[model samples]
Target: MPEFSDELCARLREAFQRTRYDADGVLEALGAAAHAALGRGEPELAFRVSRYAGELGTLIRLFLLGGSEPSAEVEAALAPVTIEDALAVGLLRADGESLAAGLDIRPHGDEQGEWWVISDLDSDLLGGEVPPEHVLGVGHASLSLIRATIRRPVGTLLDLGTGCGVQALHGARHARRVTATDVSARALALADATFRLNGLDVELARGEWFAPVARRRFDQIVCNPPFVVGPPRVDYTYRDSGLAGDDASALVVRQLPAFLTEGGVGQLLASWLHVDGEDWADRVTRWLPPRADAWFVQRDVADPGLYVGTWLRDAGIDPRSPEGRAKASAWLDWFADNKVQGVGFGFVTLRRAEVAHPTIVCEDLRHAFDDPLGPEAGGWLDRVAWLREHGDDLLATRFRVPATVLLETVAGPGEEGWETTIRRLHRTDGPGWQHELDELATALLAGCRGALPLSDLLELLSFAHGDSVEELQDAALPMVRELVRHGMLEAA
Candidate 1:
C-alpha cells in the first residue's frame, strides 16, 4: 500500500506541478491518481485533491508563460498527503474513486485551512528567486457563482489579484478585451500564459491594488483578493496586503470607485473584522467607497483560537511541534488585541449606479448561496442596475418576468437551493429587502392589472386552485420573494 501510495501521490504532484495548457499528460496522470485515491474510500482526500485540478491548470499555464520557480520549493509543495487530518478534505481510494456527489466546498471555521491551499499556486521550475506569491486560483464554488449569478452582458473585464489567472481566463471568454493585473510578477507572467493557453490575449500589469489601473476604469471587474487577517506567514506578497487588521478587505471596497465605469460591476470574495467593541456591520459598511452602492453578506464568522489553529494547519504546521504551538498563540493574541470578535469571510459586490445619489444595500445575512460566476452572475450583473434604479428587488420586483424563469441548479437533485443576492455600488445600508418587497407588491399590484389589492392577492390565487385566498397567499409570498431575489421577477 505504501509503494502504491507513493507512486500515486508522485503522479498527482507531477500533474499539479508540471501540467500546462493543452498538456493533457499531467491531467491524465492526475485523473488516474484521483480515481485511485477515491478508490481508497477517503472522501476527504478525494475532495482535497479535486481542488488542485483548477489550481494546477492555472499554475502550469502561468509557468508556461515565463513564470519560473525554485525546483526545491515546487517539490516541497508536491509532497504526498497521507496523514489522516491532512487527508480529510480529500481522499486516496482505489475503488472509492467516484465522488459521492459533485459539491463546491462549503467552508466553515475561522482558520480557512483549505482556502489557503486552493488559492495558492506554484511550480518548481524556477530557483525560488521570483519573490513571494499572491494568488487567486479558481475554486468550484466561486466558478459556479460566476457562472450562475451574472445575468447581464459585459463588454470589458478586469481581474485583480489574478493569481493563476483563472477568473481572468473565464472573463476573457466573455469580454472583448480583458485586463488581468496582479501585484506579483509571477502571477502576471502566469496570467499571460493562461491567456495564451486558453487561446486568449489579455493585457497584463503589475502593481499594488489599483496602482496600475489608475484612471483607467472597467465595465466588469473580478477580484479574489487575500483578505486573510494578520501575518499569515513571512510570505508577504501572497498573504499580507498591509491593511490595518481585517480592514484588508476594505482595500477593495475603498478603492472601488477609481476603477469602475458608471454602471460597471465588481464581484469580490473578502474578509472583514468582527471588532470587539463595535458592530461588524457598521465597521464593514465604512469600508464602502464614497458613492458606490454595495451589497455585503456576512456568510460565516470564526473565533480567535479556532481561527489561529485553522491557519496554522493551512501552513501545514505539525501540532506535535513546540514552534507550531507558539506561533498559534501569537496569532490568537493578534486577533484578540485588535478587539476582533470574529473574522467575516464572504462576498462583497459593487456596481456604479446609473443614477446620481446612489442607494446602497448593506446586509449581514445567513443564507445558503453558490458561486456567482455561472450564467446567472452575468444576468445578476446586468439586473443589479434595475435594483439600483427602480428600487425593485428580485423578491419584490413586479415586472412581468418571463413566464418561465431560469433555475440554475447544481448537478445533483439533492443540492441546496441557490440564493440570489444584490450588491451596492458603494456606500449603503440595509432594509435593502424592504425596497425589493415594496417593488414586488407593486408588481403583484400590476401583475393583477390593479384589479386586486394586496389583501386580496390571496383571493386571486384561490381562483386558480380552488384553495382559499389565505392558503394561496401563504404559499405564494415565499415563491415571489425567491423569484424576485433571483432576478426572474421584477417590482411593479
Candidate 2:
C-alpha cells in the first residue's frame, strides 16, 4: 500500500481537474462502442479506437485501461508534476522508459456533481481473484443504495461499513456531520484519500459494525454491510462476514435501534435467506427491534443454484475446475441441509417510532422509476407516518390525485365496445404502478379535485350505485387505503 500526503493529493486533484478525466468526458472521448466494451472488461476495443497521444488519451490509457505509456508523454500530459512526483506519490511505477498506473482512480458522481474515487485495482483488471483486504470501487449495489437512500437533510449521519467512503461522501452533501466506520484499515485508508481528494471532511472510525459508535445516536444511518450468505468461512472481507447464512443482516437489524435517535431512519442493502417454511417478509420483520417501522422492498430473488453460480462467477471461479466443482457442491449441500428455498436481495428502509404496535410494510417492488428515487422514498415514508396517525379519520380526509396520475382504458376488439373495456390508473413517477378501476372507484376518483371530503365522494358513489354510505365505505376503504399508501391519492 502507498501512503498519501495532503500536498501530493492536492497536486493530483489539480492534475485530474486539468485533464477533465471525469465520467462524462471520458465517455465522450471513448465513444459508445468502446465505452460499452470497457464495461464488459474488453479493453482491446477501447485501446484500438482511442489511439491518441493527447493528455486525455494518455490519462485514460495509463489509469483506466491499465496500459503502459511512454514516460515523456505522461510527463507532458501532467506537466507541472514531473514523473518523479508521480512516482513519489505511488500513483505511477516506472517500467523501463514507460509508466504504469499503480492504483485505480476514476471519477464517480450523480446529479449532484463529480468527484474522483481512489481504490485498489479492480479484480477484473487484475485478471485474478481479489485479495482478502481488497477495497472495491463503486459497485452496482453501491450505486443502487445511493439512489435508494432518502436524502432528507439530516443532523448527523453514520455510514457503517463505509468502503471507499462513497456513501459517506454522499452523506456529506445532505448532512451537517457525517461519520464513517469500517473494519478494514486499508479500506479506511482509501476512504480517507477519497474524502481528502474531494475536499470533504468526515469523521473516520475504525471498528466493526457499531463498536466504534457504541452509546452514540445518529439521526440517520446507512450501511451496505457484508451481507452475502455463505458457509462458516469467509473469503472476502468486503463481501462476506464469516457468519452463518443471513446472520450478518439479522445482526445489523437487531443493533439498529440502540444507535438510532428518536424518529431516526436507516437505509440498508442486504440479503436474507428464505427458509422452507418461513415467509420472507415475516422472517425479515421478525429481525427488527420493537417499534422500528420498516418498508422492505425485495428487488430480486434467486434460488440456491443460481445464487451460487452468480457469486462464484463474481469471484472468477471456473465452475468446470475441480476446486470450483467441490465448492459448488459444498454450497448446494449447505443450502439443502438448511432447507433454504431461495435468497432475497433488496433495500430495507427503517424508522424508529414510539408506537405500541409498529407498522411494517414488505413488498416485492421490481418496478421501474421515472427518475432518481431518493426523494420519492422520503415522501412515501412520510406519507406512511401520516397514514398511521390519520387511519381512523380517513373518511373526513380531503384527497387529490397528483397530476402524474393518468387513466387508461383498454378496449377489446370488434364486438366489445369501449364501455366494456377495463379502466386503470397509471402513475408516471416511481414504479409506474397501475391500479384497476371499478365503476364505483372510478366515479369517486374522477371527482377527487381536493375540494370535497372522502366521505362526500363515498356518499355520491353510494347514491349512484344504489347502496348506503356505510356499505360503500366498507367496500371502498381498502382500495382507498391502498391508493393512498402508493401515492395515487394524496391527503389534502
Candidate 3:
C-alpha cells in the first residue's frame, strides 16, 4: 500500500480507538478515501470507487441510526464516531492466509451491533478466493444498493456473499435478526471481524450460496454474490460460481423466488454476459420470479476482448508482469474465439409484486440510482407491470379513451411549435399539428374508453392514422411511465 494510504488507514484506526465515530466526519473521511482510491487510476480501484458512489445510501441510513455518529472535534465539542462516514476507511485488510486456512466468522459480538468473531484474514478470511489486487476491498456499488433500495423495516435479512459482513452489519439496524453467509469460511471470518469492529451483532454462516440458509426464509435478502461469468478458480469463489459461466447470475436469479416471502425483497449486485445467441433483455426476462416483479437495468456492456481483459487485470494477471503475458494471452484468446459480444453489469431489485398476471418488462437504463425515483420504490416496482395488467381494461372502458382526441406526431417537427404529424401533413415551418379525424376514425373507437392497451394502442392508431402503433407506443410509454411512476396517472 502507498505510504499516504497507510497513514490514512492509521488515522481511521485512531479515530475508532477514541470511539469518535463522528457522523459527518466519518462520511467525509470515507468519501475522501473513495476519491483517493479512484485517484490511483487502477482498474479495480476505479470499479470500487464507482461502486462506493452508488452505495452512499447505505451510509446515510447508518448515520441516522445510532450505530454511527458524526466524527467529533474538541473544538466543536459535539462530534462522535459514525459508521457511515467511515465506510470504506474502517475496512481492515483481510488475512489471505487465514481465509484459506478455514477460519469462519464466529460469534463474539453483541449479536445486534456490538461484537463479532473471525480468524485472521491470512489464514481463512478469503479462503483462497482472491479478488483482483486492484479491488483491494469490496466494490462500493454493492454497499450502495443495500443502502438505496432498502426502505421498509425488515425483520430478518440475509447477506449473501457476505465478504466482510458490511451488509450484515448494516442490515442489523432494521432487521431483528441479520445473517451473513458465504461459501468461504474465510469470508465469513472477515465479516465477523468487520461486525465486531463495528460493534454489530449478526449471525455468520459458512456454506455455498443459498445452501446454508436453505431451510430458513427471511423478510429481506441482500446479496453481493459472485455473479461474474466464466469458470471458478481457487480464489474465484468470491465471484465465479462453479456453475457455467454467466449461468452463475442466472442461478441466483432463479433461486431468489424460493427464498423470498410472498412480498419480500431481494437486492443484488450482479454481472451477466451478452451471449452469442440472444438479447440480454430476453436472457434475463427468463429469470423473473414466477410471482415476483423485477426492475432490471443494463448500465453498460463491454465486448469479449474488453470483458476478458477486464477480469484478467482484476485477478492481478498483468500481461506485462514477468510471468503474466503468456497466461493472460491464452485467456484473452478464449473469449474472442467464443464470440462473446459483451458483459453487462448493474444492480437489480426484486419484489414479490402480488398481481394475478406474470409480466416481464426490461429496459436499458444507464443513470444515477437517484434518477427521480421517489421516496417509495415500491411504485417503480409495481408500475413496471401495471400497463399490461390494466391496459386491456382501460381499452375496454369506452369512457377511458376518447375517439375525438387528435392524432399528432411527437417529433415530426419542421414547424417550431407544431406536432410532427401536423408538420408532416402541412410541411409546417417548425412544427405542425394535424387533426387526423380520419386517423382517429379507427383508433379512437379501439381505445376510446381505454380498452386499447398501450401495446394495441399503436395498432389502433395505425388503422385510423398514418403512423404505426409501434412508433406511438415507443414514444408514449416513456412519457406516460414517468407520469405513472410519479403518481401523476392512476392505473385506468
Candidate 4:
C-alpha cells in the first residue's frame, strides 16, 4: 500500500499539475485515435505516440502504458515530489537504472471534474492473472454506475462497496458528507490515498456490506457491488462475493431499506438468475421489503454458457487452458444443478417510503438512453409519488403531454389508398420508450392539453364515439396511468 500524508499528497498534486497529467492533457499528448485505443486496453499506439510527448508523455508511459523509464526522466517529471519520496511511498520501483510504476494511477473525470485514481495494475498489464485481493481501477462497470447514479444534493451519502473510491469521489461533489466502506483492506488503503490526492475528505471504514454503518441512516446510497454470479468461491475480491448464485444481490436488496432515511434513494448495479420455469421479474421483486418503492431495469441477458465464459475471460483465464477448462466445467455443472437458465444484468433503484401500496416496477428496458439517467430517475420518483398522492382523485387531475413526446404512425398502401398499419407513441428523450396506441387511445390522448381534466376528456370522447362515459373512463384510466408512469404525461 502507498504511504499517504498531507504534505506528500500536496507535493504529488503539484507535480501532476505541473506536468499536466490529466484527462484533457493526456488526450492532447496522445492523439484522439491513440487515446481511444488506450481506453480499449491496447497500449501499442499510445507507446508510439507518447515517445516524444515530453514530461506528460513520460508520466503517461510510466503510469498508464506500464512502461519503464530512466530514473532521471522520472525524477524530472516529478519535480516537487522527489524520487526518494516517490519510492518510499511505493509509487515507483527501481529496475536496474529504470523506474517502473508500483501501482496503476490513471486520470479519470466526468462533467463534474478531473482526478486521478489509484489501484492494482489490470490483469492484462500484469501479463497474468491478478491476485485474489486485487483492487480494480476504473473500468466499464465503474463508469456505468457513475453515469447511472442519481446525483441529487443530499445531506449524507453512502458508497457501499467503494473499491478505489470512484463513486465516493463523485458523491463528494453533491453530498455534504460521504462515507465509503469495503471488505478488502487493500481497497480501503488505495481509496484513502485516492481521496487524499484529490484533496477531499471522505470517511473510510472496513466491513462487510453495511456492518460498519450499523444503526446509521443516509440520505442517498450508491453501490457497484461484487455482483458476479458464480459458485461459492472467491477468485477476485472486486467481483465475487463468496455467496452461492445471486444471493449476494438478493442480500443487498433485502437490506437496503434498513439503512436509508425516510424518502432516501439507493442505486446499485446487480446480477440475478433466470431460473428454469420461473419469471425473472418475480424472482427479483420478491427481494423487496415493504414500505419501499423499487424499479429494476434489466439491460442484458446471457445464457448459461455465455455467462460462464464471459466471467472466466474477465478473470484472465483462457478457455483453452487446463485450469480454465476445469473451472468452466464445474461452474456449468453448478448452474445446471441450480436450474439457472441465464443471468440478467441491470440497474436497481430503491426509495424508502412509508406507503400502503409501494410502486414496485420490474421490467426490461434495453433501449439506449441519450440523456443522463440521473435526472430521469429523480423525475420518475417524484412523478410516482405524485400519482400515488392523487390516486383517489386521478379523474379530476389536469394532464398534459410533454413536447418531447411524439406520435409515430406507420402507413402502407392498401386497396383503399394509404392505410395506417401501426400507431405508436414515442418519447424522444430519456429512455426512448415506445408504446403502441389504438385509435380510441390516440383520440383520448389528443385531448390531454392541460386545459381539461381527464373526466371531461372521457365524457367528450364518449359523446363523440356514442359510448357511455363510464365505459370510456374505465378504458382510458389504465392507459393514462401507464403513460404517467413512463413520464409521457404530467399533471398540469
Model number with the top TM-score = 4
lDDT of 3 by residue, 1-492 (tens): 111133343443454434334333334534666435534543243333333432232222222111221232211221132323323333322223210112222222222433223322221123232443112233455435554456568888888878766567667777888888887755665565556555567888888789988878788888877776654443456556666556777777778767887778887777776768888888887877577777675666777666666665565555576556665566556555656677888767777656776545556656443432212355565655666555545433222322222334455446676443421122121111122223343343335344444556556566766777667655555544443443433444
For model 3, where is the 10-residue window of minimal lDDT? 424-433
What ordering of candidates by TM-score runs from best to worst? Answer: 4, 2, 3, 1
C-alpha TM-score for every candidate: 0.59, 0.93, 0.61, 0.97
Q: Residue 440's C-alpha lDDT in candidate 2? A: 79
- lDDT (Cα, tens digit) per residue for candidate 1, span 30-58: 47665466346343443445446554523
In angstroms, how far off is 308's CA in candidate 3? 2.6
| Candidate 2 residue lDDT tens string, 1-492 | 566767777877888778788888888889999999998979998887667536888889988898899988888777666788778766788777789887788999877899988887776666776788888888888999999898889899999999988999889989999999999999899899889889888899999889999999999999999988868778888888988999999889888877889999998998999899889999898898888888888888898999998887777677777877998999899999999989999988888888887778888877756565567668777888888899899899898999989998777766554444799999888877689987778889998889999999988887787999998899788888878878999887
Q: Is candidate 1 or 4 superior in TM-score?
A: 4
Off by over 4 Å in 2: 78-90, 93-97, 411-422
Query: lDDT of each model, Cα atoms only?
Result: 0.53, 0.85, 0.53, 0.91
Q: Which portions of model 1 show Cα errors greater than 4 Å?
A: 1-131, 134-152, 231-236, 354-356, 364-384, 387-492
Q: Write the residue-wise lDDT of candidate 4 on 1-492 in tens digits.
A: 656788998988998999999999999999999999987879999999998899999999999998999999999998888999988878888878899998899899987679999898887767787889999998888888887888888999999999999999999999999999999999999999999999999999999999999999999999999999979989999999999999899989999888999999999999999999999999999999999999898988999899888888887888889989999999999999999989999989999999889999888887677676777778888878988989778799999999999999999999999999899999999888789998889898898999999999888988898999998888888788889989999888
- Model 2 residue 422 distance off true place after TM-score fit, in angstroms: 4.1
Candidate 2 versus the native: TM-score? Answer: 0.93
